[model samples]
Target: MRTIYKKELARIFKDKKMVFSVFLLPVLIMVGIMALVGNLTSRQMEDIENHESIVYMMNEPESFTAFLDASDLHMDVKSVETEAERDDVMSMLKEGDADLFIEFPENFDSLIQGYRQGDEVPQIKTYYNPSEDYSSSAYELISNQSLEAYRQVLLSQRVTDMNELQVFTVNSDNKDMVVQDDQKASGKALGMMLPYFITILLFAGAMGIGTDMIAGEKERGTMASLLVTPVKRKSIVLGKVFALMTISGISSVIYIVVMGATFPKILGGDSGLDLEITPEQIVMIGVLLVAIAFLYSAIVILLSVFARDLKEASTYITPAYMVVLVIGMMTMFTTREAGMKDYLIPFYNTALALKGILTSEVTMAQYGVTLAMTLVLGGILTAVIAKAFESEKVMNL
Candidate 1:
């Protein structure tokens, strides 16, 4: 078994294309794509921040104007009179010269105070060209700010003293009790995405090597030669599966390290995510990754053994990869914690377990269930592949 394992490893590593596909391709692609996306996002944010929004206001309130003026947004505010002039402002917006047109109703301040006191509120009209980027951005900023300012005014009138509010008085002392610190929150956010990334890498890394191991060799007439040697068929199957698992595991680790180092920079430096994964959690993650890799490699090996050539194996494996990806995506969008029944599923259990581990939400029961299921599935597939190895027809194919 050891000799066959060593031989398989050596043969796989010797193929430069296979080595690159298994080890370096995922990292390079992840880094390159993340850097590009991050750069574009950073530029868009800078543009939004530095943009000088041209705003036209009709009967604008002094309070709202004061709020905008006190802020650091680069805005060019102009006051206009009469409905006809407001029409001209709308024309400017449509023509792309101005970013926004806001109109406050007559007696705006008195009406707002009245509305806060249970009277009907007057609607404020805002116009901006949705097709224009600057206009849309300006409208979003101005509308949010205006609404917040109005909310503050209403709250001030209703709650003269926050200390006297019953809700505040009760909850003030317990504010820190339920608060998740920056690090934990960051871990949760990263957890949401990391599972999907790792799952895909594991399957992909295993697919290339697993297909080439049996299918490629069979196509090249090398598999028969290796089979006729003085080696046990079970050993041959074990050796190739072990080699595939090793390569897949290595690729997954590289992907994790690369994503960990680069995801923050891509999201922007000030994102304030603290991804301090604990040692225990790291161990859990490592175990989960190994289980998932083993399961995926075993499945790939089964497909490869059944295939007559690399193309046939890839054709059979592509849909399996897609199924895994779709399952991973479903796990990514999951808002709730994993239930007991969730661990009963195979590929999906790995994704949920990964999420739980990263977010520090996994239970011992869940971990045990996922690991057990994965091992059972892997063992079953390995047995099937070993049986196939002893079949003359399968070997001849």
Candidate 2:
């Protein structure tokens, strides 16, 4: 078994194309994504810091309008008198001229104070064009800050002394923040990066290892020659399967290492998001890596078992690429601290585990369950593929 493993590894590295595909491709893809993400994060942070976004208010009281002037955020505040003007402001937001439009109803003062006096809460509508990412983000920030300011004013009404001390009593002591930087535990960069890297790695494994193990061997006639040897047919199948899994494993590790080594510097330099990932978190990421390798390779092997030749195997494996890619993207869409529903997903578990490891909250039970599922699913795929290999038709093909 050891000899077979060494021989397979040697064979893979000996092929320059295979070595580049299996290793270098994933690294390049990861670095590219990190650079793009880091740039976007930096731009967003800059917009937050420097952009004087405009928000138009209608029928707002002097007190409420004064609150926007006193706030820390940079804003080009304006007042509107009619619905047509409000529509014009919304058009400006849609045209990329204004950030957002805050529509205060004609009875704004009465409605706001009435709501505070245990009456129905008045709806405060903020119009934002969804097509603009920064605009939407700015709208949400301003709306939240405005609501906070309103709350502070109401709270101040109760205090005999309306000073900065009242702001401190209502603000600082009221909210609790629990920070968990667990995403680093998953062995990827901060934010929506780990999932992208995982998806790319899955594609590399399916295309590089999957194509080479099945199709490339057929093209070289090595598989046909190996079958005629004295070794048990099942051993031959297991040997190739193990080889492909090893290739997949290596590819996964390359992705983790490239991202891990570059992420801190990228974050500090451009993204400006800092994190502290421990050695134990890396161990958990390793657990996820092993699980994904075996699971993905087993499935690819099963698909390859049906191929008549190398060209046919590559065609059959295209869907494997699609499935893994979609799953990784879906995992990216979901926030970290994944709920019970995420636990049931297959490819998602690995990404989730990676996210948890990166963020630092990966539990032993989560790792155990993810590992078990990978083994069970991989075992089923291996058995099915082995059975296919045992067929005289497949062997002959």
Candidate 3:
């Protein structure tokens, strides 16, 4: 077993191209893609914040105009009272040339001041293009800041005693209002999507390595030579499967490390991601990751054994890869808790476990189920592969 393992490692290491593809390429691709997305997203947000979108006001109120003049919103507002002028502004909004239009009710200020019970509420209608990003952002800023401030001002002006209109304040000092769990919060964001990427990455690496190590060797007649040795068929299977698992394990660590270190810095910007992984959680993640690697490797290697050549093996594995991707993606938006019974399923359990670990939500029993079931299934498949190896018809071309 040791000899076969050492020989396989030597043969793989001798191929520099394979080593680079299996290990280093994943790091570079992850870094490059994350960096590019981060820069583009940040730049877009900054541009929107700094942009001065054109705003048009109809039926202008003297008080509102004065309020706008006194404030520091820096909005560019145009007064278009004529029907023809309003139509022109509407065209500009649809064309993405204008952002927002505000139309106040006639006698807007007088109605607010003299309002009584059952009296009609003063209305302020806003128009903007929802399809345009600038228009949507400008609408949000104006609505949240300028319009809300004006409404508060009107309320205070209408009441004799400002104290009478006000209810008790809640968290006036806004900074201390939120009880933040930075680790848990960041984990929630990551938990939604990281499992999918990790699952895809493990299977992707295993797919190529498994096919080449088994199917490619069989096609080239190298596996036949290895099988004739004095070592038992089980040992040969163990040696090859361990070698596959080693590559899968190393690849898994590389991907997780690279993604963990860089994704926070890039995509998260100043608010970086911090996973609250204790020693125990770290150990669970490691154990779960290994179980998944074994599962993926065994699945691929079994398919490779049944194939006459690399192309035929890939044909069989392609559908399996697609199925894995679908399973991984299913949990990307998972919000509800996963029952312990959910952990009995294969690829799904791994995804759920990772999500729970990141969010600090998974229990010991869930992890136990995922680990036990995965390893048992992998061992069963591996034993099947060994049995197949002993058959003359299965080994020979």
Candidate 1 TM-score to native:
0.80
Flag the better candidate by lDDT, 1 or 2.
Answer: 1
Candidate 1 lDDT score at position 116:
49
TM-score (C-alpha) between model 3 and the true structure: 0.88
CA lDDT, candidate 2, residue 367: 68
- 1-397, model 3: which lDDT tens digit per residue? 8877787777778889988998889768867987898789889999998898789999878999999889867579889888899899899999999999998887777787779999999889899999999999989988667899988898777777888876888877688777878888888778777887787778888888889888999999888887886779898888888888888888888888788777777766566577656888778888888888998999999999999999999999999999988888888866677898899888898888888898788898898888899999999999999999989898785
Q: List the residue pairs that clash in candidate 1.
A: none
Question: What's the CA error at residue 118 for candidate 3, in Å?
Answer: 5.3
Question: After superposition, which runs of candidate 2 have C-alpha atoms over 4 Å from their true positions?
Answer: 1-7, 44-90, 99-168, 173-196, 219-222, 269-288, 324-373
> Residue 86: error of model 2 in Å?
6.3
By lDDT, the best candidate is 3
Flag regions of model 1 displaced more than 4 Å.
14-21, 56-73, 76-98, 104-122, 129-133, 146-178
Candidate numbers sorted by lDDT from highest down:
3, 1, 2
Q: TM-scores of the models, in the given order? A: 0.80, 0.68, 0.88
- Write the residue-wise lDDT of candidate 1 on 232-263 in tens digits: 99999998888788778778877887888888
Cα deviation in Å at residue 275, candidate 2? 5.8
Residue 114, candidate 2: alpha-carbon lDDT: 59
Cα RMSD (Å) per model? Answer: 4.6, 6.0, 2.8
Model 2, 45-73: lDDT tens per residue? 78666777777778777777667667766
